[model samples]
Target: MRELGAHAAALAARRPGEVRLRRVGTSRQGAPLLLLSVGHGSRQALVVAGPHANEPVGGATALRLAERALADPRLTEGADATWNLLLCLDPDGSRRNETWLTGPYTLGRYFRHFFRPGFLEQPEWLPEGAAGAVLPETRALLDLQDELRPFLQCSLHGVDVGGAFVELTRDLPGLAQRVAHSAARLGIPRELGPFDTLYWPALGPAVYRVPPPDTGDLAAAITEAAVESTWFHPRPHGTVTAIVEAPMWGVDAVEDPTRPADPDALLRPVGHTLRRDTERLAGILARVRPRLRDTPGAGRLLAPVDDYLLVGPGIADSWDPDAHVPGARALPLLDTARLTALRLAGRRLALRTAGLLHQLVTASGRDPDGVLPELDRLIDAWCADYRVGCGAYWIPVARQVEYQARVVLAAFDLAGRPTRPHPPADRPARHATPRPEPVRRD
Candidate 1:
């Protein structure tokens, strides 16, 4: 973010006529979250990147978009909309991953530094605190949305492995095609990722339609702070929210939408691993609980991950194997890319859990028996395993960044285009809104 901040400021200086940089909000750690306004227009479009600290690929793209927006205002979906950019939403988390950002962006380095906010701590999770004491970063985004009610908003996100994909608040006409085209132009193939399509069904190839988030303060019984599904809830009707997920590594399997022939072969081991991870994580939590019970912000760091590792499996198991996937195709699942990515995800989760434990024990200042040393060994082992098993396909960083930017333009097109749920009865209807009149050319 320091670099991006410098760049954004520099862009404003260089393009004084087009760029205007301002501090939109402050992070939990007091880092300024910046907003770069690039065009002088009536319609508003908001774009944010780096919502998840671990997913920093979008950060680079956001910077590129900021620069491009200045040179060509139409990139902001034309001069009609005043394009706004939030360079980094999760500066706190993003700073945690910078250790690998500079170089050695190897699979090992990534998992070693991999850290995502526990579910409750995620930016999308709302009611951050008792009242206005909410997370300043999240508050900034919410306030921006309320003020702008943007015709289109996109949060740039990239994945660890598998092909690229997208998520939108609604199923818009030609939007999926545009997403496919933009990604295709970059030589990147569409992928639903390993388990993404399983969880979030697709509206079209490689375009997973995010179900509209409920309009309620998410306070599940699990924790008073937030719930698992407290996603970025779109505030205004007809406002479009989109997310494009590029990946570090990808393969053709992601797009096939095929059912694995030996379902048991892939299902059993992955299932076992999930359950084992859950049990293993629970054990660690139990052992560490008594010691770090009162550690500052422990609940914020602990509860969400604990629930994620433990509860997610039950959700998967409850689904009958006999039932067809909501969007699953009968095509033969021939590639091992998805399977490899799935396993890697578990390993990453384990590494992240171990890392938190190390933090917890050391911060507790009560491990006279050198549990921290033991944790060091455990974390080291996980790292070694992750490194050894890091055999997933890697997408070029440039490719990842470019796809992220192009998808935003596609999202704008979707927002402007007419939409209605049909052809696919499962989708809800989206009435077409009048496209904003493009600013007159000089």
Candidate 2:
């Protein structure tokens, strides 16, 4: 986070005539949320990075975009949009992930330091449930959206490893293909299936457009998931919202477009395992939640894992290979390796469950009792075991950064297509192509 701040500060200093640097708001930790406005244009586009701290790739890419725009405005030269760059919306969380950002990039290492906010607590999912109550960071982003009312906006996002893909408000003609080609050039696979229950309305290869999740209905159930996407709220006028997701690890399964050798049999064992595990977690929760009631911040800490355990079982039942839509069929085969990775994710939720329980007990002003020692020992074992086998599937930092940058540039090009008052290409004439500008090379 310090390094990112330094780079932005230096760039703003170097090109005062072109860059205007200012704090949009302060973070939970009192860190200033910085915004860099580059170029002077009538239409404005907001590029946000570091909304999720673990996804640091976007932060670097955002900086690169700012630098590229400064060096040669062609990146945005023909877009007729001024750029508003939010350096890092969640510095508090970004700082938490910084420990793993520079080191050995391994799955275990990443998860060990992984610190995503409770989904409900994310910067993107905000200002809805609490009657516009928000973190300072979220307030700043909301403020920027209101002020600029940008014609286009993108939140840079990355993933553990799979392939490159995108999330858009709707299918833009030629944009999905353009994004797919870019990822293909880098040997990154386009995620072919419903990546999760979250996204829907798949546009084309590697593109998805999910409607805003129900804030009120979900809040009553999960109590942890974010209630709204900032982009969807206040319903901007024809403003295109987009996001890029790249994997840190390079997986051959993602690179290939083949189904599992035995599609029918592939997911069964994993489903069985996760189901059994889910049951075990549920049983444990029954025993633990009673002891944890009224503990300090324990409810907030438990909200996510509790929701995961409660909701995870039904998730497997929804996985019907035959029911896959066209783009969904393209998803990487959920083989043993991928299933194992999913298991690790479950382990993470479990670890979170135990760790939070430990905190609850330790801080309860209660005496160190029989169960507390037992919890401590179990947590230690999980941590140690994680270090040994967690980072098997890994990608180098340089490759991850390179692929992300390429995708970001491609996205900018696709989004920068001439905007008409009505976005006519969503119709049958999309193939005729929208006017495009000269592509910028990094």
Candidate 3:
């Protein structure tokens, strides 16, 4: 976070009037939330990175976009948009995941250092009317959204292992297709099916419409009010919000379009395993609950794991490989494997959360030793699956950044103009880095 801040500061100093760096607010852990604005144009494009602390690609994408905007004024000028970027939205949670940031990018290392806040604690998924619980980082983002009333709000998000995909607040007809095509051109697979946005309305290949705020039973039961984010609110005009996803570790299974002869047989065992593991973890949390009370901030720290235990079983029970949805008679092997990997990833995250909570308990001079051995065993078992098979490989950092940057740029074009946009036949379009002219700050 300090390095990011320093780089932004230096860029601001170098460009003086063109770039503006403002200390927006402080995070829950008291890290400064900085908003960096580049270029002055009629439209406002708000790009939020690190909304989910574990997804680090967005931060790199923000810097890449900044460099592009600084080098080629035409991107901003042509789109008629001022770019407002929050480089790291959740620094407190991000700091927890920093151990693997400079990466060997392996699945074992990634999960070992992973720390994702519960949905309730996330800046983007805070429950409505629970303003009292809003973190400082969320408040800053909310204020910025209201002040800007942006035409385009892109939240940069990613998956643990999968092909690249996207979710939009509303359809900008051809935008998703263009983004997918761009990813394909870059040698990145367009995620075929069964991603996080699987239930949302499909816009095109690898893209889905983000469902209405608080649409499902799970959301209603978990959150006190309708969960909302910059995507739903602050839309004085029609704002096209995009949640762009890439993978930390790309997997071939996510891109495979084949279907097994008995998809259900392939899926049932994994589903049962996930449920059994979730039940076991819940029991462990239940056992350790008494000792956890003495740990300061234990509630905040363990909320994610607790929430998972509360919701995980129900989710697993509802999973059906043969469930019918639009245009599909059976789940493809691609989606079947993707969803399995996705759910297993969630379980691993829950385990990591438990591990962190154990650390806190020990630090507070409380021994939650009864559950420590079990937690270690669970971690080892979960980490083993990801290490072998599952088609997991470390995706180059450059490839992830490039794919996300293209998505952002394409969204900018679609949102800036009223007409339906066409996917470019050429490579991901780039503006020649001409000499930048000094522009007034907004």
Candidate 1: tens digits of C-alpha lDDT, residues 1-442: 8998898888889888777899888898999989888877777888888888888877788778776676675664475777888889999989877877876666555654556777556675554332332667777887777777787888887777556777766666666666666666666657644454444555766666664443333322222222322234443434777877887765545565456677557655655665566576667667778877778867656755675665545533423244454653342242454555455556555666766666666668787656667666766775655444553456678877877888877776567766654445235235443333222111
- Which regions of candidate 1 fall more than 4 Å away from where they truly are? 76-78, 127-133, 185-189, 193-199, 214-237, 288-304, 312-316, 319-348, 358-390, 420-442
How are the candidates ranked when ordered by lDDT, highest leading?
Answer: 3, 1, 2
lDDT of 1 at 146: 72
Model 3 C-alpha lDDT per residue in residues 1-442, reported as the tens digit of each score: 8888898898899987879999988987789988889998888989999998888888889988988888887877766778998989998888878888877766556765667777777887645532654677778888888788899999998877667888787777676567656765666656756436544556766776767677445434352223556567755567788888987666656666566676667666665666787777777666777877777767666777776677665445445453333443333334454555555455554556556655555546745455666666666666666545565566678778988998998888777767665444233234332332332111
lDDT for predicted candidate 2 compared with the true structure: 0.63
| Superposition TM-score, candidate 2 onto the true structure | 0.75
**Candidate 2 clash pair list:** 108-390, 192-330, 192-331, 193-328, 193-331
The local distance difference test score of model 3 is 0.70
As a TM-score, model 1 comes out at 0.78
Report the CA-based lDDT of candidate 1 relative to the real structure: 0.65
**Candidate 2 lDDT, tens digit per residue, 1-442?**
7787888889889989888888899998899898888888878878888887778887777777787777776755556657788888889878867767777765545654566666666778753642574677777888888888877788888766445667776555566657655555555545544244233565665666756656554523342232566656535456777777776654444334344578557555445545665675566556666767777666655666666676556544434344443433243446444444443444555555555555555656664345566655755665554444443245555555666666656656666576434333233224333343332211
**Best-matching candidate per TM-score:** 3
Clashes of each: 1, 5, 0
